[model samples]
Target chain A: MLQTDQLKFAYTGGDTFSFPDISCERGAHWLLLGQSGSGKTTFLHLLGGLLSPKSGAIRLEGTDMAQLSGPALDRFRGRHIGIIFQKAHFVNALTVGENLALAQELAGVPVDNGRIAKLLDRLNVGQKIHRKPDRLSVGEQQRVAIARALVNSPELILADEPTSALDDENCEQVLHLLTEQAASVKATLLIVTHDGRLKDKIPNQIRLDS
Target chain B: MNILQLSWKNLINKPLSMLLSTILFALGVGLVSLIMLLNKQLDQQFARNLEGIDMVIGAKGSPLQLVLSSIYHLDAPTGNINIGEAKAFLRPEHPLINRAIPLSLGDSYRGYRIVGTNHNIIDHYGAEISEGKIWEAPLEVTIGSRVAEREGLKIGDTFYSTHGLDINEDLEHDDAGAFRVVGILQPGGTVIDQLILTAAESIWEVHDHAPAPVGAAPAEEEHDHEAGEEHAEGEEHTEATHAAPATDIPLHERVDKDITAILVNFKARNAMTLNLPRTINENTNLMAANPSYEISKLFDQLGLGEQVLRWLAYIIIGVSFLSIFISLFNSLKDRKYELAIMRTLGASPGKLFLLIIFEGLLLAVLGYILGILLSHVGIEMIGQFVKKADRYGFTGKTFLPGEGWLFLGALFVGLLAAVIPAWQARQTDIHDTLAEG
Candidate 1:
């Protein structure tokens, strides 16, 4: 469900910051590891359709990511791709459930309270639904972001250095939850990070040149 | 859950700043709306009485004052033109000089000042008498609805005049003539209702002779009870020298002189091509003023106050916009990861752009609603103050909604101010924010 061919990438205004060819199939779990400034986040941004390729094409479920525009890209991203930022940012003014509800509304989806409740319960962030991210613990915020990402059951999941601040045990738990969510959706999961400790947890891995 | 709640919540997060901005927006539009409303009401008030006998040739102090006092009854008139000189000026080719109504002021009956206009003021100017006929002379009178209600006068009732611009109780110093309330005029929503209507002859006749007996009042030849009775009671009826009607003349003709002003009308208003300039400089003693031009010039002279208020209002609005901008701009530093998280959630940059702009548009609309409400309430408060000052003989209540354009304009300005920041959000780099996070 994911395809790339001769996918060389470069920053639009610069000669450096290029990415080598890489491709992954549906349900594949992979970790992209690199040192700081090695462009792991940039490559993940490209995979997530958050950045347009300078010279490569990204296809997901036979649809070219470059072909979508405006609301189409938004809709495609809403139902088929989910991302967990390193810090689990949220609309701080809103409660957890409302944040989830907004993702659905901005994506033009129906509000499904039952599903949201079940997702919150599974992520262990159920009681925090009525609270804003600013008031929640860091772990709770991470779980809330996970619930938001899985709320729409997207086809692909991407995370950008989401476990850097956690202890080894908590990092393992978050990684397990991320993998479990990807499994439930039958999605391909790609995680970008500079840490090497998580290398053994995933079967497939790509290392970027420093 | 939708954009609206998010917007409201965002604004509520910083109450002090939100309030400051709202006040700024309110001030910008509020002042402009106030001036426009007052100007419109005053203009309508001025235009209403600008009817009939086409020229006003008074002693030229300020024609506006002459017009205001004589026609609109707002101030003391520039002193009266000599009755003889006014009539002589009408001898020119102006056909519409068809009639004259010399107004005589300077006395008050209860807070309503008594004006001496031609008795023909009723028919000629369409002052419909709801009760009785027009007064025939100075001592005979008519009251407008407002005057009648305030003083409680009716036909056959009489009242004595006090000596100034407003109500006073020097009844012993009152004029010897007790004005008969011959008529009570209807409500015309014009300056007429605030006035005590009387013939111009009555004004001149009432003040023309001092210590004059009431029986010898002008135009009383047909109705003076004392003259008729004394004529019958004595064989030497001519002995009461002052007990005769001064003239059996019509009200305007009885004046036998120039009017307070000449109200000129063209055979057609388009006749101004030949008349405007000639009319402006035609007489050495009189100056023809274009009402609109003069008012505009007056606005130019007083432009400082208007500009200060206008800019103050705009600056307040500008500050409001900046407040909104600052709120969002500061919030941007806090929301980097969240925005990046939205990006990973497949949320397009365009949706994020809408979020900021939506907040601004909502703030502006709320501020607009509050501002309009404040303006109406403010004007009503002013009206009350004016009405209570009615003791000074001013009609003090006027505020209207035709001035909505000012508020609408402020709202549009706010919408435009939000565009830049919104565009910046749309173009933000998800990688930078996410990487930083």
Candidate 2:
């Protein structure tokens, strides 16, 4: 479960953007709708604890993430949040399997190769585990990214413009995989995007004003 | 998955840059290390030969050349000193002098110097005979260990001496007396090991006369050779000439003899003995040179060139450090995003900092190991040429203790080159970098 109250942020010398409060329970999926410059990505980043809000409480399972800082905050985010970006990026030096193993290690959990293989098999990216990210196809790369994000079975899943680069068929397949994986892990899912195709996919909605 | 593994992967990813940095570092280290090894080995050789003897009394010229020729046998002597003037200190019962060993040079066989000195020289060098007995008369030679092994000279072998201290065929004294090897010295690891020893009277006997009938005498000496026949033959020839055994004639009754030098040791290093070199240099025509002083001055002169080379080696190392800094800095620019992504995946800023440092350290350690190996191999190859040319016995098989400091110095260079890049990695703005994508 996740909740936020009057979250505000500002880039250096830029105008402040105030975000609305939102409460989501376990295993629920939501689409955060916005136009360009609407600060939806900023809101998702705040919820993921990548950026601390200026003045607000972002409570995830009863702890205010805005109060955490430094290594504690980094470890908290790794253990509790899964983030997916529009373009699938990875540490290019590592293979797919190694990237997942790094994610588990950074999250302070013992590396579980069996769980990683099982998750990759479920996402249909099992064959690409030993391949470098650059050698994987776009859709396959996206699936591997999803597997990395969900490897820790985090409590909250955040996707920032997840389907902006994908075609309709691949976009639909990715959205289905994201929701189904979130449900299996019993995590709250929030997808932030300007893409209108995702509006009909999830009923729970939060929209940011430009 | 670990930081070290990730650092290794990143280093090998750009193999060309890594190879360039490593080779540059290795070249600098190898050059510096080779200079040190050569300096140490040459110093050991010089010091070994210079032990015990206080001063060298020879014909006046360059003091360094006198020490080199008389002590090391590595140069031409500064002409010969007359024994009439030098015998003042060469007397066995001289009050100020503990012992004086005469060296009469100018003849060599197979490039090894044939030194004509008495048994006092053998006792001074602690050279024990490994085979046969010491030479008791003229033309009865006792060869050094290295001379014996190199020329295959054994007891009773006869070889003719050359005119100078070289292996020139034109200088062969075919009409002169042939030196019969009466003994072979043990491997004493001193200058004596490279010499062929005989009584100093032999040198005078050989040069004072011309065309002795001993040309055919070597074949007859070899077949019926006994110690008595050789000694009697040598004594009969020396007795016929004015160059008699040095001890038989009293110091005041001696004739003028042409000896090259006298290696003198004082009973005590006091004012009288210390002042002897200045007194001899000023009053007498012979030059008295302190071996240790001349050797140190020689090293100082050679140290100038060594210092310049050492500075050059350090400059090369500094330039290599710069190259390493540039390589690490440039690669960080390309890896900024990857670093930010690592932060987002829960890697702390400290981890990113350590990762960059680890990469730099890996390069340095690799370069250092390669450099040490290259230097020893280079020295071994150079040692072969030096051994063939001057026979100084240079070797690269031993490692110096200072190389441990060099290892630390190399690691310090690695850490120094990595500091800025690692600091930048630690300061990486995760939000901005991730959002730029």
Candidate 3:
């Protein structure tokens, strides 16, 4: 469902990164492993369409991401791709339900409260739907973030070190939930992290050299 | 869910800041609107009563006082003018005068002036009698509609007059005989609506008990005969004799046998009209004043107070704008991470910009509504105070001029205050911001 070829990126007056090419078939789960300063986060951003690649092309469901710019790229990213960042962040002023509804609205799609409630229920966070994101515990907040990423049912899901802040048991449980949710939606999953614990669980892996 | 809803949530999140900005904005707008209401009403009141009469001739004092007293009935008279000396303009055959109405002052009932004038003054105000006949005899008076309504006086009711403009029972002229209410006039919406009308003979008879001047004949029989003839001639002929009969009181007697002032209307605008006031001031013992000119001077004197107040209001508005800018700028700093998250959720930079601007506009709209309500309440309070203190009835429901423009001005201020902050929000780097968090 996703493919990239020699993707490269650089910040202003900063270090440049040339990423190894990778390809994932539909419904495949993979791990991207790298040490510190190895452009793991940079490669995730380029694949998510949050940043334009300096050179090369990222193909998602056959459309080249480099050709999209402005609002068109933004809409494409919102509808076809979802990213779970390392930290759980939300609009603090809104309740969990409103935050989820805001995601649908910003993606320019009709909001389905039933779908949101069902998704949260599957993640075991249905009872906290009315509570603000800050009022929830760390585990509950992580589950809500996962639900937010999966709400659009995008084709490709990218996670950036979502388990780094949790204990081993909670980290294993979170990874199991992520893969199970990805499998249920039939979406390809790619997790970028420095944690070695995830290497044995998902054998399909790509490593970035520093 | 919507942009407006999101903006509302953002504003409510910081209640103290929004409240402070709204209060300051309301105060500034309220003061300006109050001044506009007062200025417009004052102009309307002055302009409505200042019509028809061309010049006021009275004792030599402040020309403004003469206009205020004889035209608006709002102040004490300068002094009295001799009817004999004022007779030239009072005559029907005068070359440049069309109508001259005489006023006899120095008495009031319950703070309303008892203007001792003929029915020509009634014609001058265009008042139609709603109840009874006009006064035909000495001590018979016609009450204006407002005076009758306020004092509960009807035809056939009798009341005693006091010696001056204020209502003090110790200065009551009860011994001068009670004046009967012979008529009640319809409301003219002019200065005449606050007056009690009587023949000038009533004033003479009231003060006739004062010691006579030296070498003056008693003329008691002539006085009685003239009063009876005045009753028979009705009020029409009384108009022509308002000044002439002063000389008829025997010229060798005291010149103090006088009326308060003469209000003159010109037959045509001419060189004589230009020179009339100079002629009166130079040759006669009376001072002539143009009501419009004196009123313009009054506005000029009042303009200083208006300017100072206007500057204060503008400064307050400026401060409100600054406060709004500061509050928004600080809140934008706090929400920078949240805005980046929204961008990650697919909100465009333009949408974020509009969200910030919408918050500012919401505050301004709320402040403007509060300010308008406050000004109306203030106007009602002032109307009550003026009615109680001066017996001048004022309506507080008048819609002020320039308020529509004021609305636009307030919206412009909101837009101006939000521009920089909104631009800052639009330029937020989503990648850098999310990376930090």
Candidate 4:
């Protein structure tokens, strides 16, 4: 359902391409592994509609995301995309449910308390609905971020160093949650990480320099 | 997430920055709100005072000053006219003339001044007594509700009159006389609350039979000494003193002789537009000032006075908008990877742009809420100070927003400020941002 062609992108007012041709397709647990400044993150952004490729096209359910404008693209992204970051990007002022509710609202979906409650339950942090992100532990916060990302039931999941701050045991649990949720939705999963420990478990990886 | 979620996240991401922005927005909008409240209350007050009268004729001085003093009770009176001269103009056959209620003011009981007038004053003003009927005769008084309450002066409470504008001894010509609060008038929300309403006979009576202080000498013997002294000095002094026209006879014994100004009400539609006021001013030593005209003139300098303040508020609001723009723009640079990741997940660059724009919109909504709250509180605070000053006698104590449309405009500006920055974020290159992720 998701595919990226030989995507090429360059920064405005600069001659250098940030990354070379990047390609991705659904049904694989893909990992963009590279050293810092090696363009692995750049490759992930290319697949993500956040950056338009100068010489490539990205197709999500056969519609090019790079060409849409304004609210149309926003609604499209809200419904079809779920992103996780290294740091939990939960809104600090909002309680956990409110944060997730915000995500649901932005995606043009009604706030389904049942789904959100179940997600928080599966994450084993059901009691923290009213707690703000700042008051949560690092592991707990990451769980909230993961819940927010998957809450919209998008067809694609993107995580950037999502498990870096987790303890070894929590890291395994978080990664398992990301992969399992993506599989449940039949969504494509992409992890941009320098964490080599993930390679053996995913069985499919895309090294940025390869 | 769309605008609400994304915008909320941005605001929460940096708690300190968001707080600062909200505070700035509140200040910008609060000033404008305060001015509106003041204008509304003061204008309401000015309009109330202008009611029930067409023209105010007073001692020849600045017409503005006369209106302010007679009607508003805020500025100095132009001059005091003699009752004989003022009544002489009331010819029985005059065509444009209607009821002329002469107002003689000088003495005050406690903090409120005594306004000497005939029953025509009560009839014209229709001031129903909140507690008792209107004053019956001279030396009788009708007090306003505020005055009665503040001074604890009930219907029979008698307070000694101090001569001149206030309760002081500087211009102490008479201090023995007193005004008995005869009636308490209803709350009219005008300058009348600070007035002591009585007949012109009351003022003449207060001056008459004014008890001499505890002393050995008497007034008739003293007058002989003054007359003997002036006579010995020159025959010219004797002539001038005699020329005073029986002014020595305390006229209250025969008739009321001290009407400071006559407020004339004419039925002619164009009476105020042309001849009457000019005739009154030109023919007599008294000056005629139109209350509506002068009061409106006070508010006419709006381009700089009120408008400038509003413009300054707009500029402040603009600055806040720019601040939101800059903050969102900076966050955009930082969220490049985040946006890129969302894009890869199938969020189009357009979606990303919308997300950013929506974030801006959210910030504006938040700022607007805070600004409106601050405005309400600000008006309340202003009301407190104005109540304390009691200079202009504004009746209400709450900050009431008069122009709801203007408030909506402010809200729109706040939203626009937030959206611009968020929109700018959507324009960032997802391809490049994801690379750095």
Off by over 4 Å in 2: B208-254
- Docking quality class, candidate 2: medium
TM-score of chain B of 3: 0.89
Candidate 2, chain A: TM-score? 0.98
Once fitted onto the true fold, the runs of candidate 4 whose alpha carbons sit more than 4 angstroms away are A1-210, B1-6, B91-93, B169-175, B209-256, B271-273, B301-304, B344-391, B395-402
Position B331, candidate 1: lDDT: 69
- lDDT tens digits, residue span B319-429, model 3: 999999999999888888778877877888898899889988888887787887788788888888876664555565766658788888889998899989999999988
Model 1 spans with C-alpha error above 4 angstroms: A1-6, A12-34, A53-59, A62-74, A193-209, B1-9, B58-64, B78-96, B152-157, B171-175, B199-247, B251-331, B390-412
Give all candidates' CA lDDT scores.
Answer: 0.67, 0.84, 0.83, 0.67
Regions more than 4 Å wrong, model 3: B209-256, B390-396
- Fnat of candidates, each listed: 0.69, 0.55, 0.52, 0.28
Best-matching candidate per lDDT: 2
- Name the 10 consecutive residues with the lowest summed lDDT in model 4 chain B: B216-225
* Candidate 4 or 1, higher TM-score: 1
lDDT of 4 by residue, B87-200 (tens): 544543446666667777666665567787766666676677788778764456888777777778887776666656655654343443456677999977667776788766
TM-score per prediction, in order, is 0.79, 0.91, 0.90, 0.72
lDDT of 1 at A195: 69
Rank ordering of all candidates by DockQ, starting from the highest: 2, 3, 1, 4
Q: State how far residue A74 of model 3 sits from its true place (Å).
A: 1.8
Across all candidates, the chain A TM-score values are 0.94, 0.98, 0.98, 0.91
Give lDDT tens digits, candidate 1, residues A1-210: 777654555776774565666678898898888988787877787777776676667889888886666667767887788888877778777789988987777667788988888899999889988987799998898999888888888788888887888999999999999999889978898898876678878878888886
State which candidate, 1 or 4, has the greater DockQ.
1
DockQ of 2: 0.69
Native contacts present in candidate 1, fraction:
0.69
